[model samples]
Target: MTAALASENLASADAAIHLGNVSKVFGKEGADGSYRAVDRLNLDVARGQMLAILGKTGCGKSTIFNMIAGLTEPTSGTVRVSGKNPFSDFDAFRGKMAIVFQSDRLLPWRTAIQNVQLGLEMLDAPPADRKDTARQWLIKLGLGGHEDDFPHALSGGMRQRVSIARAFATNADILLCDEPFSALDESTAGKLRAEFVRLVKENGKTAVFITHSISEALEIGDRIVVLKRPAMIAYDVSFNTDTSAEERTLIRGRIGEVLAA
Candidate 1:
């Protein structure tokens, strides 16, 4: 038992996320009408790694995230995060994992600093501590002077920055982003994307990023996983800062071919 435990722990260190032969079926099959959102999917994401999950619309990408986020259960197989069942241990992950959705999702009434402090509040941090943390994050995200501004008074990009700051302020063990920058204009998105990559790498937090754009995945991911219809892995490839421009173009072309298939 000691040997098995050691092995499992070691594996967890190597991969913060593990899903084995996971399948999610909604309803019964045949006449009952079943929908197989994900089928026999397998994925392993290493610790401190940023993984980009790329898929087109209706490819069941969100289903996979729902399972990981402990929002839903898979009909068959298993899903684990840092070696623990995310679903069975949903409460255990409260402040340990943070998610950023496509939209800013900021509270209209809360000031930027107030919004950033919300997560720390939920995590039960003390008043002074939370305030300091929120202020630091807002400054880090380039909103120091605007901390007192309400979401309604901020621009789209600034509101999104607050949302990102809110997530970072939690200092979570893992970050899950679902098309977070897609709503922004290309210039704003590109700028934020660069900052995001730097922050994630510097913090060494494990992350799973979901996006429909192949280029975005390539830009941000240490590893890219492409999913086909029914959420099956079509491409799993490693990328690095050292990857040349020609290589990047080739990789993009390959991903285009895979998605087009």
Candidate 2:
């Protein structure tokens, strides 16, 4: 790999995503109109770190991811990838990141490998190189045999896997996942979660995941950040050390308390 690839790998191992004093407001200001989706949110996601944002519905978790993906602009503050603002120059910012939304958003007519190649297509990567890169990721995600299968032919879990492979195929340093595994069955979801963690670790990609399941968050997050009603960061907990069985139970209890408060 070249020096740039080496730096991408190294950065992915440390801190790849950062949100500083960020705030977002929707609608007009007046007695009749106004809503603050995010409020002065300050968070630092180290490269290679897997951070999960847990909150009740409508707590602005998705909004935060949107800002990071440059899909929506922050009303105030900033979102940075490698110290550059994602909002100021979205194209450049996006070159360093990829987002997997709640929906798979796969092209129905395309085969699994083709869908994975779509990212490279948008970036205008050479045809032969894109094909090789796409196949590599599809195989990495256990979709090697299904490379020629279309979205409709695969199961839900398999489809989601394709989505993930596509995201990683971009080789982006940061991965923004918004409830990507929320729609699957418990067993399937759990399996995918484990696989996701493994992929992040292997690729050294920094990730920010949003989920409503407390168990899911605890299971995969290196750190969990909770958002309370009206959208504010209520608590931030790190789970860097190996978690014991008892510790896992305790963490779940703590998350319950935060949600209940």
Give me the candidate number with maximum lDDT. Answer: 1
The residue-by-residue lDDT of candidate 1 on 144-167, one tens digit each, is 899899988999999999999999
Worst 10 residues of 1 by lDDT: 7-16
What is the TM-score (0 to 1) of candidate 2? 0.90
Candidate achieving the largest TM-score: 1
Please give the distance, in angstroms, between residue 111's alpha carbon in candidate 2 and its true position after superposition.
1.3
User: CA lDDT, every prediction?
Assistant: 0.90, 0.86
Q: lDDT at 110 for candidate 2? A: 99
How many backbone overlaps does candidate 2 show? Answer: 6
lDDT of 2: 0.86
- Residue by residue across 107-221, what tens digits does model 2's lDDT show? 9999999999999998999999999999999898888889999999999999999999999998888888999998999999998899999888888888899999998898789
